[model samples]
Target: MILSIKNKTLAAITLLSVISVSVFADDNQLTAQEKADGWQLLFDGTDMSQWRSFKQPTVNEKWQIEDGAITLTAGGGGDLISKKTYKNFELTLDWKIAEAGNSGILILADEKGKYIYSHAPEIQILDNERHPDNKLDTHLSGSLYDLIASPIASHKKAGQWNSTKIRLENSALTVWQNDVQTAKVTIGSDEWNSLIAKSKFASWPDFAAAKEGHLGLQDHGDKVWFKNIKIKELN
Candidate 1:
């Protein structure tokens, strides 16, 4: 009787362990409800079939899949661009940076440009507490890089995941960080040009010139991880 009881307890513990692992294995997948809502996984956390190096024919090997996240090895990969261009859409992703790391998400990225930054407007990603770039409001996490500052500083510490959402529709752009709305702006308006004139991108004629282009992830020579990358197109 004692042996049977011990065996039953061991089996229950083993079953619970398997259940927990199964839950974690589904972290980067979209549920049936998400598919019905028009959501699509951009990363899927296992491969880069949806992305490629900017202007290159292949996905850069430096961007690797590890533990269900797309991780960038410092100084190993060039910027990555989505294979499909989006004119208006909603993007959601989770990112974690190493101490003092830096990166960005570029929207409307013109693939033919010499560099992604020269043509796309960026959603800044940095270690706000440790990166020197954090000193400037427009360069901090969740900002419309160098153009608009996040009204609320809501970045998590380095090594912790930060949830971000960017929505663009009919020329209006909104950014959310950690579930909090952080910035809103209208593209191509007088106010938009005014802000651009004050930023480092002022001299780049190609900057923000396109209404439709690929999305890009920066290769800023810092270790960064991105997961749960998904998007939905808007009419």
Candidate 2:
């Protein structure tokens, strides 16, 4: 069912994201040939060359690279984001809690200090059974942060890596957990727009209106590890 909704949502936002992407292009960097070739690694498993902390009014003191993975350390704050702002792209990464009582998030469609969930929707990563942050509508691992909830239960043991795939085409968003689509969402729909209008993004410029933006990894600071990050730039 989740996969079905994801496909349908992609169909709905295909036109919107494409049109918006063209409008938002900083440069015509990716040619048709590039899209035809194959996938690209956003994170080569050994470097932090492609990501940085979220700008202004935020901090990520807990992020570190260990054993080829981005791991969370003590006192980490805020989120880490891609240096390359994207209009549309497919992203893959893996994450897991270090303990049975922790949580984190994988964010997309971001535009700076606006409400975290309102501007940058996140895929929740948590130990559902024991995490201190566990909650139904918005706190479960694999959720769309606060916008959409995961229909299935995912409680990968603490300290065990779990995978996630996220694809965002302008307003269209899809998420997969352990190779299964877990949540699908379309922004700018009447329903999505309504939610946007009532949230912090309503008064924030380019909050959720962006065509291209960064991919963010949130640090909720309870010990999480991330690796195998990659992406295939889309046209």
Candidate 3:
């Protein structure tokens, strides 16, 4: 077909647009890698159906859904807990700490948010220089709570977003901040056994056994926000 230069240009642009959208369509969907591994979105920017308060059963307190993300509207009173319990999985989430200094916990194997089962440990969040726990464990922002503080310092400025990841296997646990490995521990291993023998949890049943459990975000009475929280179960 004979076409004017303007028409030719328009057609070319249209074709390019089509190609771009086609690429986007494929890219927008879950990638083959993600699909093959079967990862699901726990929060998609507008709901908290997948989460609840550790202290509340049917009602979610202070945890708000906004901008396609899950966030803590206010800190304190209670913590956010994953609606679905998990075991032997990898977890990833984004978080930010607000002013006034607060803390949160990535706790696992919690029984109704009471305490960490043998399988549950915490990746504590705090304002290193300004928070009390920071003194207890200067690795503060990314520490394995009291059990094992962050191997190194890692705390972003308040109000800035930070990414965190945790992996829990049959007996091994690893934690990452941004992209650096900050903590690693093996449950029931010699180290764990040694600690358990003298620690408070030593008497608890299933203290280090691989089992089903929930993910908990501790309430430290300050403003702490979280988003992009997801978990992938490992066979």
Candidate 3 C-alpha RMSD relative to the actual structure:
4.8
Clash pairs detected, candidate 3 = 45-68, 45-69, 46-68, 118-207
Report the lDDT tens digits of candidate 1 across residue range 69-119: 888975669999999999989999999989999999989998677888888
Which residues of candidate 3, in runs, are more than 4 Å off? 1-32, 112-119, 196-210
TM-score of each: 0.87, 0.71, 0.76
Better of 1 and 3 by lDDT: 1
**Candidate 1 whole-model C-alpha lDDT, 0 to 1:** 0.88
The predicted structure with the larger TM-score, 1 or 3, is 1
Q: What lDDT does the true structure give each of the candidates?
A: 0.88, 0.66, 0.67
TM-score pick, better of 2 and 3: 3
Cα misplacement distance, residue 228 of candidate 2 (Å): 0.7
Model 1 segments more than 4 A misplaced: 1-25
Clash total of candidate 1: 0
| Clashing pairs in model 1, backbone N/Cα/C closer than 3 A | none
lDDT per residue for candidate 3 within 1-235, as digits (tens), equals 5568889999999999887764432311333455567666666666667777664674355666555445567655476668887778888778878765666555555653254333456677766667665666633778765566665546677778788988888868888887878878787689877766765556666654545677777666676777777667898
Q: Compared with the true structure, what per-residue lDDT tens digits does model 2 show for residues 122-201?
A: 67887877766775555677776655666665546667778888887766888887877777768678877766565434
Top candidate (lDDT): 1
